[model samples]
Target: MRTSDAQTLIVEKNPNPVADSERDALLLNPVFGRVFTDHMVTIEYSRERGWQNGKVRPHAALQLDLATLVLHYAQEIFEGMKAYRLPEGGSTLFRPGANARRFRNSAERLAMAPLPEELFIESVRALVRIDQKWIPGGDGAALYIRPFMIATEAVLGMKPSAEYLYCVVACPVGSYFKVGSPSVTLWISDQYTRAAPGGTGDAKCGGNYAASLAAQAEATREGCDQVVFLDAVERRWVEELGGMNVFFVFDDGSIQTPPLTGTILPGITRDSLIVLARDMGLAVREEPYAIDQWQEDALSGRLREAFACGTAAVVTSIGNVKGRQYNFTVGDGGAGPVTGRLKDALLDIQNGRVEDRHGWLDRL
Candidate 1:
C-alpha cells in the first residue's frame, strides 16, 4: 500500500517473459547471476537534465558509448537485494529501500550522481509490480535485483562523466550457497588487500570487485569457495570477504565483527544481524577484530562460529580460514547453532512466516 517514486518512471512491459515451466526449472536449479527477469529499470542522468528518461524496459544488451566513462575509468556502482514471493498471493521486497539508500551513499562517495531515495525506491517498486510473476516463491528462492549506475558520457576524459545511467535488473535465483547452506572454506589473501585507507572498500563499485578477482581466483585454486582480504596497510585486521561481511560469534555469547573502519563494505544484512542479535540479548560489538584473535579463538573453541553475510549468500557458515602459514577450522567445520538460528530468523521475517518486527518487509 505504501508507494514512493512512481511519478518519475515510464513503464513498458516485457512482451516475452520467460515461460512458467521453463522458469520453474531455472528456479529449481537457478544458477547464481546467470538468468534474469524479463525487464530492467533505467534512468538517464546528464549535467543539464539531471535525472530523467526513467523507464522499465525489456532486458537486453545496452547500446553503450564507446568512450563511456564507465568503460574507461570504471565509474560504476551497484547494489544487490532480493524480492521474495510470500505464501500469500503478493510478493515482498526485503529491505530494498535500504539498498536504495546505500546506493545513494555509494554514488555520493564515487562523486557520481545520487539517485534520490524516492526515485530509487520507486523505480524498484514499478519494476517489481510489473514483473511479480518472476519472483520465485518456493523454498530458498527469490528474485535477486541488481540496481546499478554507470558513467555514460561519450567524452574520453579521465574525469567523472557528465552523463550517467542507472538501472535495476532482476534475476530469479536459488540459494547462493549450494549443498543447503553448508560451511565454506575461505582462502585468506595476504598478497592483495581489498581496501586501503579512505579507499573504495566502503563503496560498492566495480573496481573494488575487479581488484579482488585475481585473489578470488587464487582462492579457487586452493579449493576454497571465497576469499577474505586483510587491511591494506597492516594486513592484520579482518576487513571483509570479496562479496560479504564477516562475523565471529564467541563462546561467551558476545559477537564481534570488523568495525566500519573506512576499509570495508558495510553490508545491510550485516547491520540487520547486529540489531537482531542485540534484540535477542546478545552483545554485538562493531570493533576491529584482529586476525590473531580468529586463529586463537578457533584453536581454543572460544570462537563458536564464523559466518559471512550479504545480499546473495544471506548467511553462509565458514568452515575454515586458510592463510599462507596457517589454516584454522571452527565448530565442527560446518553450520553452527548460532549461524543456523540467525539464518532462520532472518528468513522467517523476510518470508512472512513471522512478524516484521523491524518493518523490513514491503509487500508488492
Candidate 2:
C-alpha cells in the first residue's frame, strides 16, 4: 500500500482488467449506472484515527457485517458528478469542490465522520485518472462518478457510527432520461412530501432519497416521468422535483425557484445556473412559488417555461404539469427558449466547448 505523495491515495492497479475491446463495447451506448470502470477508490475513517488507508483498487463488492450501523440506522451520504471527455483529449471534473463541501455538510447533519474536503476531491480525481480509458465519447455521455460514505460500525444502538467507509466508483453513462426528448411531464405529489423544515431535507443523504421512492412510484403510476413535491407545512408552495431542484421562467424574462430555507437541497447545478443566468444579464430570484400560481400563470401566458436542474439529469425542461384537480402546459408544452439557453450555457461550460470563465472545471 504505497501512498501517493501528490494526493496521499494508495494506488493498486487491477490485476485482471477487462480487455480494451470489451471495454470499448461496453462504453458504446451504455445504460446509466450499468457499466462501470475497472478501478475504484476507498478510504477508511474512525473516530480515533480519523481518515486513513486510502486506496485505489479493483472495483468489487463491499463486505459489510450483518449488523453494520448503516444497514440498521441509514447514516449514509453521497454525491453525484461526472468527468467529461474534452475535445482536446483529456478529462475534467465539473465543480467537484462544491460537491465535497456538500458532502461535508451532509455528514455533519447525519452525525457521521466528515471526510476532509481535499481528500474527497482527490479521491474522485484519483479514480478518474485510473479509469480514464472508461470515459465514453458522444453527446450526453461521460463518466458518472459516485462518491459515497456509509456507517460501517457494527452496532445496533441508536447512535452515530464511530467508523465509516468512503468509496468512489465510476460508471460510463449516457443520458439519465430519454435522450433527445423535447421535454418531460411531471406529476404533482400532493399525497407525499419530500422533507420537512426540521428534517434532512437540505442534506444529500440516502434516507431523503429513500423517503421519496414511494412518491416517485406514485408518479410513475400516473404516467409522469418525474414527481414534483410541495412544501410539507402549507402543501401549497412548490418545492422541487423528486431528485432535482426546479426553476420557472416568466414571460417577462425573469426566473424564479424555491428558496433554500432549510427544506431545499441547494443543488450545485441550481446554483451554477443562477450564476450563469445573472452573468447573462437575466433576473434570477430565489423565492417560493405556489402550485396554484404556477398553473394559473402557465394558462395565462405569464409563465413561459419551467425546468428542473440537478447533476444527474442536468437541466431538463418541464413541458407539462399535472395534479389531481388541474392540468396545464407551459408555453405550448415544449422546451422553451429560456430553458434551452440555460441548458446550452451549462453544457458548454461542462464539456469544455467554451471558455470556462467561472473556473468550474477541474482538469485531470
Candidate 3:
C-alpha cells in the first residue's frame, strides 16, 4: 500500500501490559536486546493485495507455516535504530530517514517488497509513541528499535515469496558492551572473510551475520571482544567488523574508512561521523586499508586511533589488534584523544546536548 494509506493504522493495545513497578525495575538496568516493550507494529503484504492490515498489536509469537519461505531460503532483512529521550523531556529519532532509505535498499537486494520510507518511519514512530514509557532516561540508555521484513509465503521454492511480513519492535537498552575499559580489543580473522565482490555484503540481511558467527566465535576463543573481517577476494584489505563499520585515524590529522564498494554495509553512524569529522576540520577519506598496513601504521605510530561505529555501539575505540601472525596496539592501547572527541560530539548531537545543525533529529 501507499504511504498515505498507512497513515490510518489500526491500534490494538496490549491487555496484559507490564506493571509500572516491574517495568521501572527493569529499566533501572535494562540489558541490551533483552527486555522488550509492550507493543509492536506489523504490516502484511501479498502479490494481489500489496501491503495491508497495518496495526499496532501486543507483542506475541507468530504462528507461521512449517513451509514458510523465509524459514528455508533466508529471504529476510532488517534495520537497527534507537529512540532517545531528549533532555527537555520529549523524544526524538536520529536520522531515521537514512535508516528508511537503507532499509529499502536492503529489501531490494533481498528481492523482497520494499516498504515505503514514510511507512517505515511512521511504523517506528507509532510504536515508540505508544510505548514511550519504556524508554530509559539513564545515561547511555535509550529505546532500541528493530524493523525487519521476511518472506511469509507458505512455499519451499527457490524464488522470492509472493507474501511478506514487515514488523517493528522496541526494547530499552544500555551499553552494547560491558562498561569496563574505554577501548576494546579486536581479533582479525584471516581464515574467514565477511563478503566478496558482487555479494550480499552491502545488504543488512540475516545471512551476512549468520556467516560471521564462526569467525566471531573464533575471536571469542582468542580472548577478544570482536572480530574484524577482511575482503574475500584478497583477504588483505580490511572490510569491516561483524556488525559495524571501521574507521582509522591517521597521524596526519586525517580519517580513513574502507570505501563502500558493495562489500561493506553503509552504516548511518559511519556517515554521520564523516560529516561531523569534517565539521571539526578533519579530512575524512574513504579508501582501501590493508590489514598489513594497519598493523604497520599502528606499530610505527602512524595510525593514531581506530574505532567502530553502528546504531547499537555508537562509537567504540579499538585499542589493540591481534591476528594469527601479528599483534599491535593503537595509540597506547587506550582511547585516543580523537576517538573521545568524536564520540562525545556524536553523542551530544544524539542526546540533545548540542545544536543539531544538520537537522538530523525528528521529534515525536
Candidate 4:
C-alpha cells in the first residue's frame, strides 16, 4: 500500500504464525470470532500530537491502565466492515471509505480526536493486504474488520479523556447468529430501550451495546435469536436490533426502514441495502415504522418480509417478533422470497459473484 499524504508504521511479521494444519481446520468451520488474524493496525491519538505512531503490529494484549477513561465513562466507538477475496485471487474492502467516515463521526460524537480519512483507510488497507492469506474463501464466510477507538487516558473526571487509542483488528469467520443461513427470530422489548431520543444511539459506542446485553439474554431465554429495542423515551416507534438495523418489505414491492432520527445507528449495511433495493426498482422509504403496524400487517401478509442488516449479519431474515405478551409471526414465520432474494443478491455482490453496479466494492 502506498500513501503520500500520511506516514505509515510497519512492524515485523509474526514469527510464530498459525500452523498449516491448525489454520486449515479452523477454516473448515471458521466459527465467527473464534480466531483472529496474525496482525492488527494501531494508531494513538492525543491532544498534543494528534494522530501519531501508526503501526501494523502483531495482535497481542494491550497494556491499558486500570483507571482509563474508557473503563470509567465508556468513551469509545467502533466500526464493523469486511474484506473479501476477489475472484481473481486478490482482495477488496466493501465501502471502506464510508466506514472511515463513520469512524470519524463516531469519534466526534464521543469528543475524541478523529483520525483522518486517509489514515484510517491506509491502516485498514495495510492490514488486509498483508493478511490476504487469512481471508476466508468459503461460502458465507468473510474477513471481519473491527476498527475502534477508545479513551485511554487514566483520568478520573467525567469529561472526555485527553488521550485515545485507535486500532483495526481483523478476524476470519463464519455466520454471527447461526439459526441457519439468514433466518432468525427476535423479540421486541418494550421494557428496556436501546437508544434514547437525544442519546448517543447514533454513535457506534460500546455502552449502547453494553446496555442491550441483558435484553438480548432475555430474548434468548424467550426462544428468540435477538432482541429489538423500541424508542427509549415513550417506547413507541421501532428502532433496531442491538447490533443491526431493521427493514420491512411490503407486498407492493416497497421497502421501509426507520429514519435516522438521531436515536438509532445509521448502519452502513442499511444504507447499502437501501441503495441496492432502489437499483432493484423497489420504492424504498426511510420513515418511522411503528411497532403496531408490524403486528397488523404481518397478520394480513401485507408485510411480506422482515429483515435486519449489518456488517456482521449482512442481511438476516427475521422470522417472528415477540413483544413480551404479544407475539407475531412474519411471512409464514420463516424466510420469505423477497428476503431471500435480497440477501442472495447482496451476498453475491459482496462475494464478487454479481456485478457491483452500485460501486460498493473497493478492490485492493
Candidate 5:
C-alpha cells in the first residue's frame, strides 16, 4: 500500500505447475496473451482496510459476485509492459517506473483507489521473478506483464466501489502481429472516433479499448491491419491508431506526432522515442497532423515515413493508408531506414545487447 509496507508480499508456490517441456513448446511460438505463467500476484483494498492481503500466489480463477461493480460499472484500469530475457542470463524490465506512474494516473482518472508506486512495481517484480522461466528469448520475444485493478464490491449502485482487487499476470509473447512483416496497413475511420476533448481518452481503462473494438472490426472487414481514428469534433486531424501512437517522418529529417491534448493517450513508448529521436540529432515536434496534409505530403514526397509505437507493438512501420476518399503508400510501403534504426536501437537497449544510455532497463 505504501513504500514502507512494500515488503508485506506473501508468496505461495503453485502445487501443480505446467511441465517444463509443455512450457517450452508454448514458448517456441507463443501467441500474445494466450500462454500464461504459473503464478500471479494479487492485492486487495477497501476503505476500512486501506490495502491488505498482498500475496504472490498460484494462478486461479477469481470468485466474483454477480453484482460486482466492475462487471457492470467498469471501474477498472490497467498497464502493459514487458520483461526481456537478458542475453547474459537474467531478465530485465523496461521502464517499469513509468508504467507504475501511469497506472496511478489511470486509477485516479477512473476514480479507483491508486496503489502505491512501490507496490505496483513490486507486484510486477514478484510475479516476473517467480515465473522467470516462462520468459521467452530471441526473435523479439519476452514476457508480457499485465497489471490491472478492478472494482470488486458487490453493489449495484452508480458510485465507485469501496472494495478493489489488483492483480499481475505474465505471459510469454512474440511479435504482436506476426514475425517477418514489420509494417502494417491502416484503415482511416471517418465514421467512428476514439475519444472526445473532455473524455477518458488519456486513461488506460477497459472502456476506452472496448469502444475501439467496432472500429477495429471495421478495419478487419476493410482488409487492413489496424484502424486509425480522427478527432471526434472535426474528423480531420489524425489522432492515433486503435492502440498505438502515430509518428510522421519528413523529408527534411524531422519527426512529428499528434500532440497530447488530453485526447490522445500519452504513450510511454512514444515519449521514449521522442527523447531517442532528439538524441539522435533529429528534430522532433508534437504538432497537430491533419489527414489531408498527411495524404498530400506522402504523395508529394514530403512525408518520407510513418510508424506506430506502443508497449506491445514496440515500433512498427506504416506501409500504406486506406481511406474512403484517398489511398497512398508511405515510402515504398515498407520499413524505412529511420524506423529500422530506431527499432534496432530500442531493441538493443531492451535486450541487453548494447549499452543502456538512458538507463531504461531494471535488471532482475
Candidate 6:
C-alpha cells in the first residue's frame, strides 16, 4: 500500500475476506451501492486535536451513541466520485480535487469541521489503491467512491458537533439506469419543493436528499423514472431532478440550464458538460426556465432535447414529461444527436479515450 507524505495512513487488512472465487462471482454482477469492497478508510476529528487517527480498516458497521449529533441535527455532507480502469492498465480518479473542494464547501455550509483537501484526496486515493481489484471495467462500470463526514459528538443539541468522523467507502457499480433505456420519463412535481432560497441546496448533504424522497415517491407512484422540481418561490421555474442536474437543448443550436441561485446543487458533471458544450462551439446559458415554457417549447418543436447529468447516471435523455395538467415529449421522444455527442465527449474524457485537456484525470 502507498502512503502520501501528507498523512501516514495505518492499514488494517480485513481478516477472513471473501475467497477469490466468491469475490469474482460477486463482481460478475456488481449492483450499485449493494456490494462493497473489503476495506474502508476512516479519520477522526475533534475540536481539541483537529484531524487524527487516519487509518484503513476492514469494512464494518460503525458504533455510534444513542444521541449522536448527526442523527439529530443532520450535520453531515458527502461526495460521489469514481475510479475508472485505464485502457492500458491500472486505474485513475476523475477530478478528485474538484470533489474535495466541493466537500469542503458542503462542510462549511453544514457548519461541520472542514476536512483538509490533501487529506481528503489522500484518503480516497488510499482506498482506491487498496481496493483496485474492486474496480469494474468497460463502459458504465467503475468503482463508485463515496467520501462523507458526520458530526459524531454524543451530546446532541441544536448546534454543530465538536467531534467529527470522515470516512470513505467504495462499491463496484455497473450502471445507474437500465442499460437499454437510453432515455427516461420525468414527473414535473408541483406539490413538493426540493430546496428553498437560503437552503442547503448547493451543499451535497443528506437532508436535501431526504427532503426530496416524498416527491420521488410521488413520481414512482406516477410511473415515472424521476421527479423534477420547480422553484419554491412560484413553483413555475424549472429547477432540477431528484439527484441529477438537468440541461436543455434548443433548436437554435444553444443550451440552457437552470441557473445556480443557491437553490440547486452545483454538480461537477453539470459544469463539465457546460465546458464541453462550449468547446464544441455551442452557446450555453445559465438562465431560469419555466415549466410552462418548457411544455410550450416542446410542444412547438422549439425544444430539441432534454437530459440530466450526474456522477452516477452520467448523461440520460428526457423522453417524456408528465404533470398534473400538462404532458409533452422532447425531440421525437428519444435521445437527440447533441445529447449523444456531449455524453460521449464527457465519457471519453473520464474513461481516458480522449485527451484530457482540462487536467481532470488523476492517474494512479
- Choose the strongest candidate by lDDT: 3
Compared with the true structure, what per-residue lDDT tens digits does model 6 show for residues 302-347?
9999999999999999999998987899989989999999999988
Which pairs of residues collide in model 5? none
For 124-223, candidate 5 gives per-residue lDDT tens digits of: 9999999999999886899999999999999899998899999998899999975888589999999999999989999999999999999999999988
For all predicted structures, in order, the TM-scores are 0.96, 0.98, 0.99, 0.96, 0.98, 0.97
Candidate-wise lDDT, in order: 0.87, 0.92, 0.93, 0.85, 0.93, 0.92
Q: Weakest 10 consecutive residues, lDDT, candidate 3? A: 1-10
The residue-by-residue lDDT of candidate 2 on 1-364, one tens digit each, is 1223326987999999999999999988989998789999999888887788899999999999999999999999999999999999999999999999999999999999888888889999999999999999998889999999999999898999999999999999888899878899999998999999789999999999999999999889999999999999999999989899999999999999999999989899999999999998999999889999999999999999999999989999999998797699988888999999999999999999999999999999
Candidate 1's residue-wise lDDT over 1-364, tens digit each? Answer: 1123335677787788789888777777777899888899988888887787888899888998687778888889999988888886888888877888889889988999888888888888888888887787667788888889999999888897888888899888887877554799999998998889888888899999999999999999999999998888888888899999999999998888998977888899999999889888989998887888889989999998999999899999999999796699988898988888888899888889999989999898
Write one digit per residue (lDDT tens) for candidate 3, span 255-322: 99999999999999999999999999999999999999999999999999999999999999999899
Q: Regarding lDDT, does 4 or 6 come out ahead?
A: 6
For candidate 4, what is the lDDT?
0.85
Choose 3 or 4, whichever is better by TM-score.
3
Worst 10 residues of 4 by lDDT: 1-10
Tell me each candidate's RMSD, in Å, in order: 2.3, 1.7, 0.9, 2.0, 1.0, 2.0
Error of 6 at 43 (Å): 0.3
Off by over 4 Å in 3: 1-3
For all candidates, the clash counts are: 0, 0, 0, 0, 0, 0
